[model samples]
Target: MQPYSHARLRHSWLPLRPCPRLLPKESSNTSDAFDTLIESFAFPEKFDFVDIDLGRIRRAARAPQARQLTLHLAIRDAPAESPAAQALSDLDAASFKLFCTPVVNLFQRDATSIQLTSTDRAYPVTPEPLETGTPLDVYSIDAVRLGDRTQSEHEKGASSSTAAPRTAVLPYRALSHGRQPDPTVAYWTAFRDPYAAAGNARAPILLSLIGLDGGSAQVRHPQIDVDVTATNGDLPSRLPIGAPDSDLVHEGAALACPIRLLTQPTLPCSHARGHGALWRVVAGLSLHPFDLTQTGLKAFKDFLRLHAPRTNIVAQRSIDAIVGLDHQPAMKWMSLDGQFPSFVRGIEIVVSLEESALRDVTLHLFARTLDRFFAPYAPTNSYVQLIIRSSQAGQELHRCPARSGTRPVI
Candidate 1:
């Protein structure tokens, strides 16, 4: 056995900031006010860099009666020579159109009372080709304004003496190139009512940018040998890779390779509204290396009947008549009520491969059963211990622990 090779590539979220010229001058009062405003918006740290426009804050601080102000935002860290920067430059040269929309959250005001609107303007902006990046001068925010309730009542044919606070529209601006904008970038308008006294207003806005394609990115690594053993002393064999999306490779033994495992970050669609928006973006990776032949399937059924005798008769009949193994590989054993049966508690898995091959094997033992006997338990620590042994001499080769929510290569 020899030492293994490893490589890692990481992509960071683009930093967000106010337009350079509009940044407020250095002052404690202005900076404090600006920081408070930036915190209220609650932009996702992984997607956009959120901060307050100091120039707007300074102007507001100096003139308390000023009714309106606009804060412009742009990407802060894209180098001119980067791949994403080049992609944006190409998009700009081609005059591609980008669309903008507003996502708002009101904390203290009624939803119907305040009207938050954004211009339907489309701008010519695009994300970097291989990574995530937003260009400068892409989005703007408008200041909050207060309207007279009495003027509203007169228009509605009602008489009222009190002049209560009426409709308030948050300020936001959109910049466009001459050509029509693409529907990629969607802006969200977030602001606290400037009319309200300082420290009393709070609002959070979320901005989502789409249209970045990750299908071009594919990861290829050395192949690793895998064997599936069942309780009846029967081993599942590898089938020919016929499916278009199959990741199995054959080199004397069945090898599993992850080709489309890594992907670029993508924002969820607009329908996933409200506080839970971030959780909707999920990435999953799974690989099934071997399949059960007709003989192996019968052996698995017999093993199931002998072990789980109390299993429902209907479930047993369904298992006996199971088909489709010829075309699709089986990944899980039997799952009853979304849980592995008690009989599948202490199954052992032996990996007998060289260190070079071990580097490519990411054993993801999920909560479901595997190979009709092995069901990795989901303990409190969220880790499953895996022991690798040498097949020739039956000696301990390695000890690896698989952790949940992360990829651990064995």
Candidate 2:
């Protein structure tokens, strides 16, 4: 994918993000050592960054690890490609935030320096943290504009160094949601049937539930504190009891739906804005008969070891898709430059998976990070009243929990 880099920053032109990864070309000699930098930067007129006002961002660069990554996002998980172009072509500006995270062992192979080159030729650029005497370990710059290095005496300041720019950090915007539902009782209809493929072997358990006809007043966004209990027949199930990958899901199975109530904020786009961030996830596994939860997680935990990118694990095969829901909104581990515990010391979580029966599979289920980032949008409390007549194109089976204890999932 062509790297797109555009910013209204007066000092720099980089918007750090998690993706646009780079893969090195393989060579015949496996023993050969190499150091490389893969970067993508473009100044497409199609992207209007003026709304973020990144022009004032300054004075926030420190190397906690050999690898330092900074992210500037106006929107969450916006796909990058022609489709994204079409989906978001209408917007002018959008909400924005800045984050800096240090990755451990990004340069374990060899010391390498990364340089970001933006296709935007008209706008010249320069490196920040203008101090020249500091140490810059192996660095993998995410989103940045490569600026002109030309120096003029007129631009020189005290100590023959460029003046440090002021740093600006934005607070998260909170959504207004009531702690309790306006009404505890509500009806829900099938939003869509899972794709036939997911319904079979790939991942068949995904069932959607949007507000039933005229139920918007009761079912709303930021519906936090989701807890619904139900019998096996109450929830949705396309795969038979012995569904494919029985090791992961099976019969006599009781499923607990840990549904994370998500909020899709109306991102501030230019008057005629485009699509909002998309959240898609499938992460449910059946447990051993009579077990009630994802017991397979114990066996799968063998593959749960988290390590650096350029390192090796004990496994002989590459089984990375073990996580789901875009790895729960693309969750990554953080190190805080090695300050906090591993539980909280991975990558900065922009989005995260909610705690559910499937929690063991991915790191995105970190409730702490998830709440902090989306706190503003979370409802004080949330409850769903359901009456499931039938599901997965199946016959009318049962209703929501009558008394209590059965968990309901959406």
Candidate 3:
């Protein structure tokens, strides 16, 4: 007792009340009542909703060694003398099945099917001491890789130089195999921090319950309640280095910013919508670091002054022209000896609509157009943007960026 100087733990006991028995309707027969009773008894209230603790999610996002996150299945203890409690007494944890489908970026192509597992076991493990609620059943998820383990220094450098920070939503749902009804599911979204230092303190990966899908009649579709604050909370008030009005000496900005084009048009004659389709188009030129040298820079300026304006190319035509520019010997060698060849990049053209829905053929035509547009530039690592916009206010709803290497199915 003297050796154990810390305070002792205390326990309290509470009295139990009688649990109500299952009562069948007066009009029901004995067989129907028995079946109802059996169904109710078999599926007890012990298995509740599943959740991942915030701390676990934070660790998964920031920890250098964390490869996956753990999900906990809440299990409650039923009254000792109840029939439901007795039914679960000898339950085989392996019989309960749960599956997770990661719905990423609202694009079906990136979705992944992952089967959840318990601690060194499959899902739905029984907690110790069936009569009293204590430990929770655990499931591990390895959907997205985190930290330096998954990326090399060169890969990280390349990604930071060429790409923006990517974000995605991961919605989860349980699959029913006819033995039991599906359980309600929920999920959160996560994005990698592009500016964070490697293997040092950075922003914690935040995960909040963004949506929930249940079997209730009132809830027709999955309701989404995202917390956007988590992602934008720590953003600096000042603009970034290459911002439009900034005076920073960024070489990439000087080369790319001057040639940008932005236009908005309402196309009332489009086949996709009889009323009108609103479009926002933005096009720009990009030069690699090697093109920033004095001689390479001169050639770029010469091409812009002499060749670019003569082409009479708008954003749409420029995108097509850039794809076929390889065939033009004069343009391809604008830079002496082709030491620093220039190609078009950063093209964004979006067509929005306010309508019931586009016909199947209309969507098919768009897909085919994308396929043809990117075909010639496939080897050059070009990509096309396909956006789905909201009908109410012509706002962007979701964007699907299809790379030239892979064709997208509408």
How many clashes would you count in candidate 1?
10
| Number of backbone clashes in candidate 3 | 0
> Using Cα atoms with residue i matched to residue i, what is each candidate's TM-score against the true structure?
0.16, 0.16, 0.16
Cα deviation at 29, candidate 3, in Å, is 62
Per-residue accuracy of model 1 over 209-259 as CA lDDT, tens digit each:
222231111112111111111010011112232346743333345666432
Candidates sorted on TM-score, descending: 1, 3, 2
> What tens-digit string does per-residue lDDT give for candidate 2 at 130-198?
123322221221221112232222224435356332211111111212354334333222122225433
lDDT of 3 at 114: 22
lDDT at residue 171 of model 2 (Cα atoms): 12
Clashes of each: 10, 27, 0
lDDT of each: 0.28, 0.23, 0.28
- lDDT, candidate 3, equals 0.28
Q: What is the C-alpha RMSD of each candidate to the true structure, in Å?
A: 29.3, 29.6, 34.1
